[model samples]
Target: MATASVVVPAREEAARLERTLASLGRQSFDGRLEVIVVASGAATLRIAREHGVVDRVLTDDRRDGPGAARNRGAAVATGDVLLFTDADTIVPSTWVRRHWRHYATPAVVGVGGPLRPLADGLSHRVRFRLLSDWWYRISWSVGFVQQPGPNCSVRRSAFEAVDGFDESLPFLEDTDLSLRLREAGRVAYDPDCPVRTSVRRHEREGYLPLLLAYLVGYLEYALPGRSPTREHFS
Candidate 1:
């Protein structure tokens, strides 16, 4: 069986990490898979231990962002495939299984797509879920897709070739890495394999502010001549 290493980067997300670990323990992937939780604080070790995942946790100081943390985890990972996910997400029972299938395809280097957000409000929940779900359906039907980073996997070699993520980015480092990942190989979406994540981060940033930050991020990246400052707006 092909070995797979799942890297989950977390900060002070005790409230959500517990459930994330729980879901991981139940993944239905048909290969040897182990999780590496990149925790960037003292509390992270406690949470990982409490959740009985310290056997695979790596505690680091908060100096490095998720990109650095992920690299720290990857350095010790012993797998052919490197999967990444957020500390505040829930994997489907068959999430890993589906990803493994995709990774088995020699032509595929990375697998990922949208994350269906579960909101507290019923109306918002319905709207976001529908939109997220519909996007998956549409993207797959069109044979063009983009990953959400939190739900992505890359060939270990490809990741190393890109020198991992650009640790310089504070936020949207995932987006930066995704761009490089696309250049390395084919990236696609799995409509049936969906992961649900908390919108707390988005909630923390608020709708208008988050939307503006997203727009600024796009503009900053698109400008090419100038660069954007670290986005702490969220």
Candidate 2:
């Protein structure tokens, strides 16, 4: 088993972070795993340690967006593979193992799994269908893109080559980074491996605008090569 670090980005997420940790503790890999929580204000150290996280709890006082925090976590991590996820997500038992398995081949620079909404709704269904169509296509599509961060991983070397996650463009940084990665190396999707994700967006804002907003954001970047704004994350 290779050394893997689970980098979870959280912001005032103490309540849900435990579920992520519990999910991580159950991974099937059985290797030396370290849980790196890149957070600020959300003191997850006690909960992470309580859940038996292998490495020291990490944080960024600057409170930069999740991208910045993830970069911070990656800098301190001592793993060959870097897995990026959200603190609100729940990883399946085989989450780490399945992700690590793909790296057996060198060309596989990026690997992503299913991002299933924890709760179902009309919004989730509509968006999920569109997303699935995008990711399953033999080739990448302009309007359709998949960079499901919660279940995505890449080799530490490749990540370093690309300079980890982009600190600019606070929102949709994964999309920005994945675009560069897909160009440099291959991005893989695991049909069998999926991770549980929160439906907070639906819970807060209804689905239609989000779908449209995402399209607008993607188009904004695609046509002009301009990164999205910080407020986009909100």
Candidate 3:
């Protein structure tokens, strides 16, 4: 009977937000599911309010980035579990339920799942499978946990203990949060709770270049005596 909250941070993504909201409405989780939309743009806020399934629509005119917006959403969330996903991602019907199930193990403080490509293209599919799905599985097996923003959930108490996602980090904020959550308890990777996300960034910026940029950013954050700067990715 645990309540859950899904926080979606969006900025000028009306079309994609529509699809994301629609998918969330079909969630199989029977508990008290609260959907909060932390939107920055006018169109995004409008779309979120118009959605029949959205329980709350919080505006973020500052547009401080997804990390800040997600923090805002989590601040007001009234659920035992706080689920985070992007406006461009489409989760499955059992997404919420699967994420909640992981919390049955008291040691599990956070849960992350695989990502699939929403766009249709062989290149997108192959790249996602290798870079995303395969990488998450392998890295997790070695104790390097990564919880992508598009499909990750955390215990409310554990999130508050870590002070939630670092608002200053422009990229890899979720990974930073995951690493911190590991200190509190187990951060699990659930392969069955996959979500399909948009590949627009890769399509626009070219996959290889973006991948290299992420690697550099991750290294900066992961290496000792180094910290991540406010380098905007999107």
Candidate 4:
């Protein structure tokens, strides 16, 4: 069995971080699973420290971005597979196992799963089903694979080959990494290994504005000669 490292990047996620860590503790994977939390705020660090399931905790005082935080966690990880997920997401018990199974294929470099809404609100469900579920499926079918940060995993060798996520990209760094990973090998989509992610951002920032921001970011990433700005999202 291949060892795996689960990297979670957190900011001021005191209220939600515990749940994520607890969910990780329940993973049914048979291989050695290392859970690392890269946190920015004091409260987030405290919560991570209190979580007995966490194997390591690294502080990111720079508050650069999730991409940078994930990079820091990935740097010290000693696993064959590096799994990336948000502190606001709750993964299923078989999440790590499902991701690890894909690595049995030597040509598969990365695997991305679906993100279901944690909140039961109608709008939340609709947004996830449309924007996340359907979107990932269709895009992968067309050879334009994209892995959302909240639920994705990649082989450490391929990840290192591509030099990891672009810290310079504030919003669509995951998508950018997915595009580059295609050069290394195949990037796959696994719809069965779904993770439940918080919809608090949409609730706080409003649905249309958040959607529009991602749309613009996607366009900027897809179109030629256009660079991604340093615009931050929270």
**Deviation in angstroms for 91 in model 1?**
0.8
The positional error of residue 11 in candidate 1, measured at the CA in angstroms, is: 0.7
* Span of ten consecutive residues with least summed lDDT in model 3: 225-234
Alpha carbon deviation, residue 186, candidate 2 (Å) = 1.2
In candidate 3, stretches whose alpha carbon ends up further than 4 angstroms from where it belongs are 228-234
Clashing pairs for model 3 are none
What is the alpha-carbon lDDT of model 3 when measured against the actual structure? 0.90
Worst 10 residues of 1 by lDDT: 225-234
Candidate order by TM-score, highest to lowest? 3, 4, 2, 1
Per-residue lDDT of model 3, residues 108-183, tens digit only: 9999999999999898899998988889999888777889999999999999999999987888888888888888
lDDT string for model 2 (84-166, tens) is: 88988998999999999888888888887767777777667656655643444433434233567787888888889888888
Tens digit per residue, CA lDDT, model 4, 60-123: 8889999999999999999999999999999999999999999999999999999899988887
Which structure among the candidates has the greatest TM-score?
Answer: 3
Clashing pairs in 2: none
Per-residue lDDT of candidate 1, residues 26-121 (tens digit): 877777888888886567668887775434887777657878988888899998988888888888878777877776677777777567775567
Query: After superposing candidate 2, which stretches have Cα over 4 Å from the reference?
Result: 42-45, 120-145, 228-234
Which structure is stronger by lDDT: 3 or 4? 3
Better of 2 and 4 by TM-score: 4
TM-scores of the candidates in the order shown: 0.85, 0.87, 0.95, 0.94
| Global lDDT of each candidate | 0.74, 0.75, 0.90, 0.90
How many clashing pairs does model 2 include? 0
Model 3: what TM-score? Answer: 0.95
